[model samples]
Target: MYKDVNNGELRKGDVGKSITVAGWVSRRRDHGNLIFIDLRDRSGLLQVVFNPKISSSAHKNAQMLRGEWVIQVSGDVVQRIKGSENPDLPTGDIELSADKLVVISRSKTPPFEVDDDLNIDDLTRLKYRFIDLRRPKMQALLKLRHDVTRTIWNYLSNQGFIQVETPILIKSTPEGARDYLVPSRLHKGQFYALPQSPQQLKQMLMVSGVERYFQIAHCFRDEDLRADRQPEHTQLDLEMSFVHQEDVVNLVEALFSTIVKEVRPTNSLSEPFIRISYDEAMERFGTDKPDVRFGLELNSITDIVSNLGINVFNKTLESGGTIRSLVLPGCGYFVRKQTDELIELAKSNGGKGLVFISIDNEINSIEKLSYENYRSPIKKLLSVEAVKSISNVTNAKPGDLIVIVADDYKVANNVLSNLRTEMGKRLKLYDTSEFSFVWVDNFPLFEWDDKESAWSAMHHVFSAPKQEDLEYLETDPGKVRAELYDLVCNGHEIGSGSIRIHDRRTQTRVFNVIGYTKKDIDERFRHLLDAFDYGAPPHGGMGLGLDRLIMILGGEDNIREVIAFPKTQAASDPLFDAPSFLGKSQIDELGILFKPTD
Candidate 1:
């Protein structure tokens, strides 16, 4: 048997070459007189022909070959008879004239097909991920993910960034999300938490004179799942000394732009991405991470709608609420059911209800509601002046639909933002290949925590407050903006970072603002606090979610597709059946006990 005949190296001119190929049977076609098997390896696919006239013994064995069977074949490469060519396959012009065949291993019927076009449940595919990896699409995604990682590593290394390892078992500090804690056997009742990111460590490396540091870090967070979120994921964590927020941002932008050009040349990126302030993004798009690819921007109509005497609007304004509207071009054709569905979606995001007006009808006043016979229930509540004001504010024209939300500013904006995304999807308003990247700066240093009745760090306690806002930190922490920035692409927050607090006084003050007492701060972060005693350099960095970044690059919805052995939504690994029970002896050694409940 030939030892090596990969799919890519085959050519029609190599007809006289003797070859050996080992692969899984992609497909098996049996004619009465002849048998053909499509063999597939990671590289690609090759066709093998078994003619009984040439070798009856080989033909008999080939007849038993089923889909996905592991086999080895010794063959003579030959050009296919002109009519027998398969124009679809890469190696279609030639076929393997088999002399011998050996079944290396047999496979049972798979739970699902391993072909690229098969539609199967994700659970089933994840359960049998090994087989799923054999599919062309999955294989390509994994390879692409590898290439992306390699390119990033090479680029960073060339740029003098040193890859450093950070500890996985770290002391947990408050960071907005629940940490995945690891039980410490030696310390009885004490635990070490898995890092949500290498936020502190990378900064410490800079403090220790590492100058520049980066790690393709694995982070764990005990959080609920979403399409882009996972309990355990990876990030390209990096930090640099002697830099400001702009320096870090420029470095990241250059890296990503280079990656895009190298990995996905077909996709285009705007030169020098647009910059948007957090307030401006929220004002125009109703979201801080606005997808700038589309133009259905949100507009305020509080003054016009509040004076119209519409109960929803007047009540909202009376209660210190705001009214905002988004005009969907050509959405006036939506039926009653679609509008009702949109209202429900908005309500779920904390809105009271959605009030929509179809501008397609020419009737201009509440009194002419019966004349135009609009589909919305609020048609009779608005005055002619209010209608005209709304149209002018939103630039609404014939065949336009204006969806308005009246609630507290935060609630109204959030609800309308989500609804805008939904409408974009339903109406096919977004371009899949379009990447609209922007920097979201001026993030609030601390957000008011209603539950705790205190101020909490919006990004983290170590993030530096902007110099302009530093004066307000002691007086009004709520109004202070941090030197934090988020890399947002097409409405997805891909990465976040900030200028770190290098001075001990500022750092301690930040903790105090978050209601951390001196004792509590020392107890939780004594090492970090102590490290700052030495002369620490000014440094800053960002962590990009590798899984989410790959998902975006590959145009995949789920992060699992880009991850090789990703856990399900429940945070369970089906392949290894991890998080399994340990034996009593092992548990006893760790001094652990589970109280079984009746």
Candidate 2:
């Protein structure tokens, strides 16, 4: 055994007991005849002292110790002097009196200190991730992740959910993002693609009569990367048989509610988890995944500003566009430069421009308001009555700035959603410590793909349309609502799911609606469609992003912090140097060829 007890297991109660401990030397200080070192293991740190009076050999050995040198020590646990105890540590009240020391392994100076929380660069940290993981902060995050997963497994197991493992390689059918395809060595010119999600297999599990199934599933996507996204990821993939829309939602709600209470007791969670329709979420917050912890809700001001002789508003209304405004409190004093930046922000988010009406002075009533009370470029074009109407609709106060966007409904809401969240961040509007979970349901079953001149499944082809909306499948697909739902937290979409089309008829109809030909359906989704024939029960479920969930719980802004090893924003791994060129022999073995570069 490496030690009788872990370094962190030492305590005042264990004083005077002889024990052995092994760990990396966190820090070492040499006093004249004595040496002190903090030994760190997976559990935590413990202070070990080497004195000539205790053992001259051990004292001499400790003198050669340096940071990150792995060593094992036989010592007696002793209580520290009253004034010398470190209250910051749990084992601070006690110290180890070392009588012997063994240098198990030596280490060179690390690229960065593990004991200090320095602002290290991402490349350096990732390249030297082995050392970075030694930090206490990183260790705690790893433990928190473990606790969360363990809690999930226990909770779901108790709920009669069976743990199932699915295949890593799956058939390549369009989910949304491109797939990371693996070339088949034995089969000429054929390939196997990594699973984006176990979407079909879990549904197949339901067909196979696994009443309830779950997996900590691995998924891959060859797509652009961001702080919250990666080339590969994990999700809590689950499906339930004999279930409806609410049954799946209720199960996920209960699972997350239990996780938050057990793993993150300090963070405040709203009870009953607020539910909103897809339309309501997009109208009020401008996004289906809204951070409801703070309110800067979007309000439609087209009715108020219509026919006011303002060319911007009138022209927008004339072209079937909508005008929406959101109030930014206390930003009424923004200078020309600040407002111009906001205009650029709007333009970047696919809006023509933004119109700002800054309320400069206080007014008790609409009758008391005047032209001079508000500041806008178009103030000369508006009467005091028009301004008051706009203000009343958006509930703008004396010190609020009303930012209005005039564009098509889709572009207008998209722009405002970005602006709302950006301003919320700059103004520190929402409490970072609070988590707001919302369930947005009733998404459209199909969206028109202008480029393809055809209809596309809004969530996925497997999603079932509402029973009442089936009539519109052939006549008016846009009006058909699907049984899709999403689990969102603090403006990040954690997962999406829906009641699946379990029968072949509806499944075939969805395939046809999405522009898939009969031959295409028989070729691509033949296995799933064929399985539905044998006896697929009414089933539905969700796949929650495991990394995003942990990132939120750990109070981290980037998902990379929660992930042990993650690719850079450009989807490159610095440590392994992946995406490298393959040798000629290897490429030829896989029957692959590459074009010559200039």
Candidate 3:
């Protein structure tokens, strides 16, 4: 028996009681005569002292202990000596005096320290995930994920949502990215692609009269990765039969409000999460996912600056484009180099250029003009009304910098959104301790794909078009809005869902709008179309990315940190050596081939 009480459970009251404890040696300090060890388990750190007077044999064994060595110790819990307590730890007030020690297992010196802040290289951490997960931070995050999932399960079950499993190997109707295919040995040329999401299946569940359904579904997509993206991920797949957009929104609001209060008590979540329309979010914050913790909002100055004689402003306004500006508080002292960098960032994000106005009296050195050199060279040429309107609209005061971009709405929003997030990070404007959750709804039904010269689903083809916008689905697909909603927090989109198209006519119209040929549509969606034939219900649901949501809740910048065995950014599993080549015979049997040519 290696344990009666956990190392972290003892306190000053448990002094003089003998007990057994076991865990890895988190830290060891030798003082010649006495040795102090901090033993760590998933619970927390416990200070254990080995003294020669108590047990010479245990003291001798403890002397050989080093960092991360696995061992078991029988000890008497004792209060720590005065003035030496670690107020940060739960078991700081007490120490364990070792009477017996056993070395359960030995470990090699780790490549990096595990019980410290996450400052290790990413690849190394992924390669040694076993060691990394042993850290208290990782353990706590995993526990938090578990608690969140368990809470959702209990909450949904009580709400009469049935838990169901969906098939992983499904025919690919690729939704947003390239499908990850699995070559079949039985069917030589045919491949089964991993489910992107349980999108179609959950809708089918609704058609089958499952009043409500939920699953922790595994989804896969072969796509470029980002800080919050992975090749394979998990989402909370939920659907309810005969529900409106508001119903789903209310349900999610209640579920998450409860989860945050119970799971992330530090964050103050709004009772009813803030809701904004898609266009409204883009107009106000320059992005659909706005970090509402700060005041750097993107305000429109198109009407104000429309008459400005500047060529860029004139051409953009004449071409039916918009002009916007972001006010960086107290950044008016920017030098030419800083302004150039902000311009370069704008150009890189597909904007024509950027115009910066330092409201401060800092004179432009290159222009070498007096303190009256205007806010900028371009501002010097503009009407006073334009300048005053921009200042008044954006609330830019002295010592503030107003960064302006004029282009098509999409390009202007793209450039300013990137700049807004970057500036917020650089200026340390966001309160790290705060969590702001908003629901962005009414997304565009279709987005233009210039290369393909066609319009495709903005959320997904399954999403139902807004009833008011249905008239424009065929006439002007770009004008149609979908009843989609996204849960966004801290400038990152947590997840999205929508009221799905349930009828054959609506689904077929969506297919046509996305330029899917009749033959292709019949081949791929025949079953789903057939299900709709069997009396599909009016269904709407949402799938929140568990990893990204947990990442935000855990105060992590990357989703990989929250996942236990996440693959590298390139979609290669370092720990298990996955994406590895198969044997020749096995590969031949599956009819897989490797060829490269241009």
Best by TM-score: 2
Q: Can you tell me which runs of candidate 1 are displaced by over 4 Å?
A: 361-376
In order, the Cα lDDT scores of the candidates are: 0.86, 0.91, 0.88
Model 1: per-residue Cα lDDT over 148-186, one tens digit each = 889889989998999999899999876568999878889
Per-residue lDDT of 1-598 in model 3, one digit per residue for the tens? Answer: 6788887777778988888999999999999879999999877889999999999999999889988888999988888889999998889999999999999998899998877586888889989999999988899999999999999999999999999999999997755789999888899989999999989899999999998999999999999898889999999999999999999999988898888888989777655678899999998888889888787889888878876667888888889998899988888889899999999999999998898887664532322333453468586676555566677889877677889998999899999999989999999987886778899998998999999899989888899999999989899999999989999977888879999999999999999999899998899999999999989999999999999889988999889989999988789998999988789999899888889766
Q: Measured by TM-score, how close is model 3 to the native structure? A: 0.95
RMSD to true structure for each model, in Å: 2.4, 1.3, 3.0
Clashes of 2: 0
Better of 1 and 3 by lDDT: 3
Candidate 3 lDDT score at position 594: 82
Sort order, TM-score high to low: 2, 1, 3
lDDT per residue for candidate 2 within 483-549, as digits (tens), equals 9999999999999999999999999888878878888988888999899999789999999999999
Estimate candidate 3's alpha-carbon lDDT, on a 0 to 1 scale: 0.88
Which ten contiguous residues of candidate 1 have the minimum total lDDT? 365-374
lDDT of 1: 0.86
